[model samples]
Target: MLEIKNIVKQYANHRALDDVSTRVEQGSIFGLLGPNGAGKTSLIRIINQITAPDSGEVFFDGQPLSPDHIGRIGYLPEERGLYKKMEIGEQMLYLAQLKGLSKQEATSRIKHWFEKMEMQSWWHKKVEDLSKGMQQKVQFVATVVHQPDLIILDEPFTGFDPVNVNIIKEEILSLNRNGATIIFSTHRMESVEELCDSIVLINKSKKILDGKVREIKKAYRTNTYRVEHLSHDVQLASVEGLFAIESREDKGENTALTIKIAAGRTINDVLAHLLPIVQIHELKEIIPSIHDIFVQQVTTKASNPLISEQE
Candidate 1:
């Protein structure tokens, strides 16, 4: 739904983004990931037209993004903004109208969303009176009331309890199922793995990774395997091609061991020695988590700047 091409943004002597490009598919939840100072906020601001790129182009639905597209998009910035003394419903109405919804339309949409989000009793509450999590819910409803084609949420799940987090998560999924394209930006890797179908990783003002979540994890596999078998004497089992034992645990009569496959050998080679003395019950290859991939990639880039030069 959105295409950013060779985007570059800078401020004075510092560069925020450099020749970065990525695609957001229609009806897909795309995760925008990066560590601090990675230019993620700069790129997001460019997409929202809050700022213009020094040299780049953004296309929306195959058309060059223009003023007319503003109403068709919704943005919830990381920083929450609400008038402290204003009534919740009134503030929501004001924000909705700014997104091009009429008073009547805005009221209707607001009412529905408020009730759906279990904020019906909060309409008359003052922004200052509500807790942080309550205020987040109010802002969330205000963002989606206009039902924009593309929704951008940065650090959206911040300051919420787990129950409310799950509630908002379901709502986001429901929106996607109903044909809304979402660009989710957050430091939370678990949420990305659970909700994002694809993602783009940025660091040091450049795009470092982009692909399906499952595929990215598979590509980052460390050839580690977890094996479970009947406990036996350590000396009786021939350990071949075993680099290291990542972990070991005894469960009643069975023992579980996580071992990395040694270089120059595969899982089959590791099994060749253990199968003789131990009756194997379970064996599976270990895939790296999104958090692991994030740290590994960013750390590698920091240590060796030339690693991602191929991009």
Candidate 2:
């Protein structure tokens, strides 16, 4: 439930965001992606009302974004902030109240989250006494203790080992499952692929790509497939003009092949030609990862400044 329309932000000679627009569907995990200085942060700040766009508008739940909507939003910035001397539980209570929670309500939520995360023993620990990961958990609790309608996370997985990353990831999914709309911003494309239903790619202060994850991947699909089959007297070289073998590997009695369909040739045509010479075991199309598309989009825009405008 957020819509950003034709946002433009600038500072002196540098334009941070330029005519960028995107929509986040209610209860969906939307990814805000871009490389450094691509205006992702600028757009995020605008959404958080940390700064206003020089032009354009943002709507929260179909209405113009205003101070009243602040309580309904939770933001966890990339730079972690916590009172070093404050006890973990005390800090959480204060932050939650800032989001409009009553003291009693904040305490209840803080206790619930602390128990849920198995960090009940950390309530009395001071922020400076905790490790980076521990402090991160405390900050995360402070952010969501108020149960805001929209949660904005930037580089949220930083400073955690794989196990802790998975822990935080599960919590994010749980929030989404419970009907919280999330705006996830990170450099981790793998996370975006795993967590986001849709995404918008920004580059050089402009929107280069924006769509549902599945549709975006479908649009970038190449006619490539991986084939595995028994190698009983197989002669792949004999089957020419059907597909180009990109890679081939021998797995004992089986052969694995990565092939791209030849011009005017269908996938079934390649399968038809290969089925006779070998016992086909497995076949699947090779889908490009979000990381691949991210790099491609950024690099393409870098080379062609007008690419965003054209799209």
Q: Write the per-residue lDDT of candidate 2 for residues 117-139, one digit (tens) a residue.
A: 88999988999998888888888
After superposition, the stretches of candidate 2 with alpha carbons farther than 4 Å from their true spots are 238-241, 301-311
Write model 1 residue lDDT over 135-158, tens digit each, in one string: 888888877899989999999998
Q: Rate the local accuracy (lDDT) of all candidates.
A: 0.87, 0.89
Model 1: lDDT of residue 144:
88
TM-score of 2: 0.95
Which parts of model 1 are misplaced by more than 4 Å? 233-247, 262-273, 302-311
What's each prediction's clash count?
0, 0
- In angstroms, give how far residue 292 of model 2 lies from its true place: 0.7
What is the Cα-based lDDT of residue 29 in candidate 2?
A: 98
List the pairs of residues colliding in candidate 2.
none
Question: Scored by Cα lDDT, where does model 2 land?
Answer: 0.89
TM-score of each: 0.91, 0.95
